[model samples]
Structure formats: C-alpha cells, structure tokens
Target: MVFSLKGKTAIVTGGGSGIGKAISTTFARQGAHVCILDFSTDNGNNTVSEIEKEGGSANFYQCDVSNQEQMETIFDEIAKNKTINILINNAGIAHVGNIENTNSEDLDRLFNVNIKGVYNGMKAAISHFKKHKSGVIVNMASIAASVGISDRFAYSMTKGAVLTMTYSVAKDYVNEGIRCNCISPARVHTPFVDGFIQNNYPDNQAEMFEKLSKTQPIGRMGKPEEIANLALYLCSDEASFITGSNFPIDGGFVTLNN
Candidate 1:
C-alpha cells in the first residue's frame, strides 16, 4: 500500500527535537502540511524553517501541551487555518526516581505532561476530527508502559496511562472514524539520553552511554528516525485497519529482555 500523506494536515506536539522532530520531519516529507506544537519557540521555529528549506509546508506554534488554556488557544488558532487530520501526542517529560524517592510533585509533574498532555491534545483535536469525519491519533508511549524499568516509577505510571488512553479513545471514537493508537519505544538515542549521561556521569559519559546502549538486546539504542519510520506507517492510510494497538518499536527489549 502506498503510504502517502499528500494534502493531509498533521499536528505534532513536542516537534522541536528528538523523536518528535523526527516524526514531524517524516510527516512533512510525506507531503503533509504539518503544525509543530512545541513549548520551545526557538526549536519549534527552527524545525519549521528546516521543513520549509526542504520545500515542505509547515508552521510552528509555541504551546505547552499540559496547559488547558494554552492548548485551547492554539487549537482555536489552528482551526482557523485548516482542519487537523492527524494528532501526534509526543510531548513528554521523563523522571528518574523509584517509588520511595518519587514524591507527589514528581508524580504529578510526570502525569501532567505525559498523561494529561496526551489527553489534552486528543480532547482539543477531537472536535476537528469529528467535524471532518476522519482523523488519526498516535501517542508516544514507552516500553515502560508494558514492562517495569528501574528508576522509572513515575515515568512508567504516566506511560501506562498513555497506553490505556489510546485504547479508550480508539474504542469511543471508532464510530466517529477517528483511529487512536500508540507506539512504545525503548531507549532511543536522543538528546535526552545524552543530557542524562552528561548530567549524571560527567566523567564517564561514553562508558555509561555504551552501557545504556547495551541494555537493548540489539546491543545499541534505537535511533530517532527508526521510531519515526514506525510512526509514519502507523499514521498513514496503510494502517487504517489498525487501531487501539500498542506497537513496540523497542530493539527486542520488551520481549527478549532478561
């Protein structure tokens, strides 16, 4: 099947860098007019400029997905220009702490961004999707959603909500022609990983990076573009039959991890 998105309009949250940037770029390359919603104005503008440089259509909107007021205003403005055909809930924050170390504030922050962010995006775009009678919603979940990981109590909790939210949206909106699904990726090689390494193990960054990469059975971390590839397919018309499913793009980490 041809995975063409020509003439389509997609809204990608956190489209400034990492997996979100990759997904936004992929959508633009596929001929979709993309709206990059990011909290980082500079990064968002840079991403839009990059897409335009490649002869693609795109716009940047500075938005904090966790804030209801900000999301509403941004959606209202976007609706004025065009109907949103795809919504990628990719804005998320990662927390490193076990249950005992994780305080209520930590859990709340994670939930607000990871879980509520996805919820807000879906909620904001549902009306547009309903009006058009068709739409695709893809959430960026994590392997932590389905499996336990060390020092990720709050992050895991939020991702689990993302997985279930995808399922719930798919079930409720099936009749409305809105497809909701999620992609669960493991240990992707993004700037976040680099930052974590630099901040935590300043002296042994490379050694720790290697150790983290080796955590995957594939012996390396997954690339951002690799996750984007899966996302591209899931959002394309080729995946019309698929919904309410969690696609694991984890270098066999979920199934083969010992």
Candidate 2:
C-alpha cells in the first residue's frame, strides 16, 4: 500500500498519448480516478477505454491547454464532482531549430502550448488546492531547461520557464500543504519520438533512431513508463516531505555530456 494513490483524483493533461498516457494509466492503476485531457477526442477516449479495461477509473475531456477559459471551466466542473488531488502539467509541443531558424511564429507557438499551457493548468487548479490545503502538482519539463541542447532554442526557453515556475509554486504554497515539483526527462521513447524520426529521417530511420537513443548515457532512450513511475512516486504520499524539487530523470545527459 506504500505510494498508493487510492481515493485520490488526478488530472493529467495530454494524457492521450506518450508519456502522458503512461502517467495517466499508471495513476489509475495506483487507485486514482484519472481525468485525462487532450485535444484529440479519439486518443483521449482510447486511453479511457484502456484504463477501464484494466479496471481502473478514468474520464476523458477534449481539451486545449492554451485556452485559458476552457481550462478554468473544466477545472471548475471537475472540482464540483471530485476533489482533484493531483495535477500533472504534461501537455506540451516541441520544435527542432536554432534561434536563426526558430521564427517568431515558432516561438509564439511554443510559448502558447509549452509555457502558457502549464500556466493555465496551474492557475485553474491552485485555488482549489489552496482551499483544500493539500494537493500535488507535477510538471513535465525537459533536460533542455537545465542544460544547453543544440537546435532547441524555443523549446529550451519554455522548459526553463516550467522549471522556475515549479519552484515558485512550491515555495508559495508549501504552507498551504501543497507541493509542486517537476521532472526533467531526457529523450523518452514515445510516439512523438517515433513520429519525429519517421518523418525527418524516413530513409535512415534505423540509423537515426540509434543516433538519438545513444544521446543518453544509458545507451537508450528512457521509457514512458519510467517517467510515469517517477511521476507516480512524486504524487503519492511517500513524497510528502518533497516539494520545490527538480528531479532530472535524464540518464546522465545533463552531467555526462562533455
């Protein structure tokens, strides 16, 4: 029963696919009533179906994290019926380019989904957490936030914001019994990575995949489940003493890259 999330309610943005999906299912399995939010209705519902198939409780909401009004409304609605105990700000988009190639439009897009999206989710949930005087917030950041990553100008910019924001929230809400933490994952093996490789290196998919996998000192990309496991621990009661912390699950990418 250690690390159990039984009777807790969790809201996971972008929970339809990739790391989000893994986190959503894992939370549900740990006895949380998972609320999955995603722009894609199909993917969201599919995740719900999978959770239900495993006898886990889950609900799907079609959501766009950048839309502030929509997020507020959804959070209000969920709070009316369930006490949201965990909020995972995992919705984000990626762009591959240096500053020279990352135009204004790309920067704005990243700001909207990667930076503003996390802001909107937290804004909607913080009040409830404060009122309840207890809640857990886990944000999904990237190693790019802490270390220099080539061709990730805009991405790194937004993730850096996520990291600092985590600290701010945790510090501001610590006395309120709310904890906020972030996970900076290196390259995680997810559908997004597969699609990126297939689209950009279609002719040399295997080679490109190998190259990307080797970027981590572990000799392979981290698994979505691995990230989810860490997330689960952070959100569970076992991490009660933890807050305002940045856990880098990067497989030495931040330290070993020289």
lDDT scores of the candidates, listed in order: 0.93, 0.96
Residue 155 error, candidate 2, Å: 0.3
Q: For every model shown, what is its TM-score relative to the native structure?
A: 0.98, 0.99
Give the range where candidate 2 is weakest over 10 consecutive residues by summed lDDT.
Answer: 249-258
- Cα distance off (Å), candidate 1, residue 165: 0.5
Question: 168-187 in candidate 2: lDDT tens per residue?
Answer: 99999899999999999999
Off by over 4 Å in 1: none
Which candidate has the top score in TM-score? Answer: 2
> 1, model 2: CA deviation in Å?
1.1
Question: Relative to the unseen true structure, what is the C-alpha lDDT of residue 258 in candidate 2, on a scale of 0 to 100?
Answer: 78
lDDT of 1 by residue, 1-258 (tens): 377889889999999999999998988999999999999999999999999999999999989899988997888898897888999999999999899999999988898999989999999999889998899999999999999899999999999999999999999999999999999999999999999999999999999999999999999999999988888898898999999999998889988988
| lDDT, model 1 | 0.93
| CA lDDT, candidate 2, residue 214 | 95
**Could you say which candidate leads in lDDT?**
2
